[model samples]
Target: MESRKLQIRDLTLRDGQQSLFATRLKQEEIDKLLPYYENAGFYIMEVWGGAVPDSVMRYLDESPWNRLRTISKAMKGKSLLSALSRGRNLFGYVPYPDSVLEGFYKEAIANGLNVMRIFDALNDIDNVKESIRLINQLGGIADGAVCYTVDPKEEHTDTTVKKGFFGRLFGKKDEIVEPKKIFTDEYFVEKAKQMEDLGAKIITLKDMAGLVNPSRAASIISKLKSTLKVPVDFHTHCTPGYGLASSLMAIIHGVDILDTNIWWFGGGSAAPALELIYVFANKLGIEVEVNMEAVGRIRKELRTVREELHAFDLVKNFPKEFDPLTDTLPAEIDALFDKAIEAAKADNEAELLDACHAIEDYFGFPKPNLLVKEAEVPGGMYSNMVAQLKALQAEDLLDDAMRLIPKVRRDAGLVPLVTPTSQIVGSQAVSVALDRKKGNPDYSNPSNQFISLVKGEYGHTPVAVDPEFRAKITGSPEEKAYDVSKYKKPENPVLPEYGGVKLAANDEEYLLLELLPSVANGFLKRRRAEEWEAANAAKKAEEAAANAAAEAEKADDEPITGEVVTAQILPGTVIEVNVKPGDKVNKGDVLLVYEAMKMENNVEAGHDATVKRVFVKPGDIFAPEAVLVEFE
Candidate 1:
């Protein structure tokens, strides 16, 4: 059989870690695997972008720029290094000035990034137009990504309207309703063509939620192949269980490249496993050019890393013998059997709960359930919803929120559910659900982001937003796109010293501080502290000893009696405070609202009490476990 070589872009380091563990894969862990990745001969290795920059600094206390440079240097000429960019957003949620984007792209390419897959959540080419041009000018391949989403209605098909005998006699004829697809093959094909015309070397069908089925994947891939002059790549997730099938269909339909991962890191919310795809591709006379030996070594190393990062592992209860490839369990025991045995033998329920919780703190927040294949919500979006509801102690509102998502999305001009849009819609849906539960009318308390979305601050929506709905969300029905040209960069953009050390020494550090101000500042302070401790070990030890002695001397004093509620999980900015001094609160009442991980979290009261004081107010940033409110 004549061999058909199929190109594969590995997502193990970027999107795989992102989907599985909130992009908390440490630099050291990546360093361990970088050598193998360079020798593996993948068509493209996704080393940076997505949630990496923010997560690295926000959680891991590492520089995102350093990671990009390190990976680029390792993979210099061995293989292509690609990063995911959110178009004009450029890894941040809101749009940045062209000058900022230009600087970021220039720095990114200079740091050794070879390709940048640029995408817009709204599928509005206007959002990505400038980024694509900027990347190409910087000598990086711009893989233009068109977000894929299905219409809320049923699959498009011809509908027959039969006329009755009296109606036929009255000259009314039987009518056939043609299949009208909002997100049709033609629709995607046209979007791909537009990107191609804008000088995009490659077109990508980016199904972030794993929502595209095999049929649609084939149709889109075929249409893209026929219509676009450039190569077509498919990037989907395993959330809806459509990834493997859709990817196989894409390969069969002549897709230029496919996004896949290695076994353990892939699947669940990530992409399809490369090992499985290789077997299937081989059967179809397609050759996947990757070193199986390096993959095996990487898998072994990943198993160790997976155990170390078990708190973020989605499948915390997997049996060793359980095979993910065939979805088979060993004859001797299964996951259920292991769970039953552990439950029966466990002596302490508290210990078990503690163990479970430790694993839930992957990115300093609870990991979402990975079994969202049958769920109405995608994994990432569903996780955010659950986290937000859990924060408010409104777990019962999950059902209502999920039900409201479609309506909310429809009203938002049927925008593709990705990134900022998905989070915006999901968060607003929860808000609407909470409002309805509070006996208020729906959309009564829309979030600031939701209002911005309806006002076209992000970009144009796929369909024209309903004028009435737009007015209801935002006071005006007028639609206006945010003019990036008018954005003025601050005169003093350099980050101030944190702990007497300059936070940003160069353009890369400056970009970090610019894109994620709060996280970067916090990380820089922590870095300074760590460096101080390392450099002055004896001085730090003496200071720690003195502090310990002082703390012990003060321990004998009478303890404060008020119950203090501290921030849990991760650091966040206080957005609103509901409780004031002398205010009474119940166990479930929200004391304050804070924004964390892009979701607004409501800090609720644990018991009935009078509010003694609020330590944090709106715009105040707090760390995890810092006292937020004091109750009497």
Candidate 2:
């Protein structure tokens, strides 16, 4: 009997880029890669949204809208394009009101988004219900996710909780830790069924951490196929190095689609190698169709992309000797699987988990990571924590932070390691460890974001938060679930300008900017200015680059005619201004005070400088990039 054909989905432009390059693969890089992806036989290409948009604005200093539109036009329906919908949160952590959600979805669809792969961090079906319904209402495919995790048995949960480097600092490690609710096959199947009922055209088994075993994956897929009427897709990472196995088992049990990336950026924390999987499936007599020529060309081209961005790409840490021509899984990988399974079957979960940890350690991982299966911290959270600590120059505290994560998460109600929840728990874990190191008394108090999460402001968690634990963080165990529609509506979308030159000329552009005004506006301003520089250059491109370089070096002390360092507040009300134009100030001195969310924030100078300009006066309400002070 013939096997059912498998549909391949490429995530190279989205998750793959984010995984390998920290999503620094610029729009131009994607543009160069797009023609190749267009012919790559992907069921759909994930080209926009997810971390890409956030990274574009924050790190790349580019317009995410431009990225999506450019790729969308290039693909020209050769394949459907999808994006990650963080449900109520969109790209940010806040659970924005439905009106804001509408703006995000509507604008994305209008700009050529075809699929809404929506998933809530907690697997809260309630949080995704509106998005699922809205995706169909707006003529987009709804792909709902059943995020994968292995809920350790009650007896085994204790083994998962470990201490960071500051293990001895946690003297308050509660002795009577309560058992977390065990997630069962039923839970996964039920979630899939709910997605099916909510108009999801596809159900995605999202194994972000690659913690799902072949046996468990088969069970979930079998149960989901029997229960749901929609096609089932699977998404996983190669970080744990077991993705190929889990994917094969999933396909055998009836997953209709699998997410992958080109070989060049395919492994590590990224997706399964699309080339490897295609060859493997075809060799196994599994029905699949692929164009080796197109894939090879793309792979060759990606090698160039990798080299061009070699400093940023982490794929070098992955297997170096992979040959895509012969669809083969390396014997080393097979050997690792043997060791991992043997560990899983050992006398205790600790032995099994240790073996798994040993395998991860065997692989030289350069990026952020906490791969202990017992802890089940998602890859994104682990990487994000590492990045955060590195930025703070305290990366030595990573091990301490890693060990602290499980404890902090459990204390905060064992919230699932997914989006806002992952970020919330992760940030708090860092805080706890940092406080412990500093002997700060408020080490246990979670930040406002974590407190809001405990209040049920984000949405329902898998299990009710522990009352005693809740009281420790927020002074009460009361969970704060709210009707998102009733939450304060986001302020009106506003336009950005420079010297009265309005940047967003249309409502669509304005709405896109509204998602992240300050970052997006600054990015657009810089990007457009660079383009203008390039186009109007009377000298060679190298000279223009050199001129920009020269200006950057003398930027702070010798700037005039609007080309000065500026600080602006977003969604803020300026209540105080500390200086006017031409005033001298010292480094770290506050230039002004603005209030956002009732919290006063100060704009400070990074270096001692004379004020070149003051863009705002006291009592002015301004959006992002409304300069507070320009430095000489």
Candidate 3:
């Protein structure tokens, strides 16, 4: 085993909160944990970036920049603070101009970020170089991440096509396949060298899927440590339970740092718990000193905090009830994970990989999560899809959607599923499933995102995208790679004061508003008008409680006499009418189907009820709270 000391980075505030709470954690919520994190003696704390600003304005109605400032103040230089950046793209999907990059980083660096970890979804070195140069120019530690993805092919000799059943159906092999993504040691070494040459101080192996096996982790980490001069760190989700083993193996193979979180915010799509690794570290004879007592106290407090966040999500949509305090997983589940980490500590790579696979099979809680590797859904998109399906009252469609995802992904040139790509591919899958339900599957045409990708908006795909697909979408053969200087200088986002709200007082606030103007103004306007925000909060609280109670009652199989599918918020087009007057339907039988966002959604009988009337017919479009069927 490598004798080097292990450095641990805590991701509870960023990836952890994002994985478990849908990034709903606001500045105030994050504040309470900073002191403990500082005391816990981590090498770095991931406090800002990665869906934070977007989610802040979109969902939490808070300023992400201010959160960083507050966190920096709370740390008081006790620990290095890091933020995730999307290379040339920054936080937004489309590549911003060089001018925009400079402007954004000026505020970001000044706001107290010590380390900037930049990554591109496609592993395009072109996308990573400018960001590395800028962070170095600013004199901040620029950490470049090699976003990890792998092919399902067992070996180079295994020349099998990836799309299988779906590919043959759509004739998709002409588009793309998985062999190119088969991440070997050479791949990691190459990416790491590119970053190092660009003056990166650190290189992060970003395994967002938590799919890296211990043997693979050891091989890659060993190769990088031998080949590169810079330190290496591993970042992954605990969603599929493979992270702990992979992290342990990486550490044994001379990894400088690992990303983890507290137990409450760890596991189930989050990072591996620091406590679990503390166990592995002790066994491996690697000393990692931390305030265990303080960590325990913080975890206890955050358990309640997490529940409150869970209630917020559960009340609003189809989010499953989460309890950080309860280990509701089967005993075998914990055993499987413990075994994996143990094997890693013992340097038993085969056992560790087996344990990792076993743990992966356990993630979906009563259901097998084998689909994660197959579907390649990022954790963020996974949580979003769960709630979206619930809001549409179409949880039954989830499995169907998951099955259709591979084809949707392959059809889009098999772009690595991360961030913006994940959402784009995920939505397309939903469209495919819904469109197919209407018996007209659209495969030739691609979504706007796929087209934009073909046009080189987000950067290059790792595998060669289908030329025909590109031509069909972009009206061109293939998008030629371009320099960052080619794009026009983009205008600063417009910021306007609303309802006597205060305008930005400084560059930091202006950047926040610029990042998301409407969300910032909405929050700032309400921050000034306490009365308005309070009243709105109260109204939402009532709605949440009522929805919770209705859900609870629905679970008990109550006779739901009135069924309103659309909530009067989103208009729906009646696509299929499954029931008519005097028709008897079972509790789970579909009564009607409506089309929205190009997907078919169903209104089902909550309890077996006789249809008294059908309110809408095929081709009828109606607003929310539209009565689809009346039951007697």
Steric collisions counted per model? 1, 5, 3
Clashing pairs in 1: 311-359
The sequence of per-residue lDDT tens digits that candidate 1 reaches over residues 179-246 is 34588888888888999999999899999888876667777888899888888999998665566666
Cα RMSD of predicted structure 2: 19.2
Candidate 2 C-alpha error for residue 356, in Å: 14
The residue-by-residue lDDT of candidate 2 on 1-632, one tens digit each, is 65668887788888888888888888777777778777766778888877888788788767777888898898888888999977877776766776777777888888889998999888889888888888898888999988876653333334634355455366345433445455789988888888898889999999877777666777888888888888888898867656655666676677788898877777677776776566446555666555666777777778778787778876555544344565454587546545544443342344444443443344433322435444567776777888888888888888777777766666665667777778788888887778778888544556888887777777877777788766776777677675655655324333333233456555655665666666666665665566556655645777877886776566545545544444454588888988877888888988888888898988887878888767666887878765456665
Which runs of model 2 end up more than 4 angstroms from their true locations?
Answer: 1-3, 152-180, 317-375, 383-404, 433-443, 475-477, 482-503, 527-632
Ranking by TM-score: 1, 2, 3
How many steric overlaps does candidate 3 have?
3
Q: Which portions of model 1 show Cα errors greater than 4 Å?
A: 154-180, 317-376, 485-501, 528-632
**Candidate 2's error at 184, in angstroms?**
1.3
TM-score of 1: 0.72
Question: TM-score: which is higher, 1 or 2?
Answer: 1
Candidate numbers, best lDDT first, in rank order? 1, 3, 2
* Candidate No. with top lDDT: 1
The better-scoring model by TM-score among 1 and 3 is 1
TM-score: the better of candidates 2 and 3 = 2
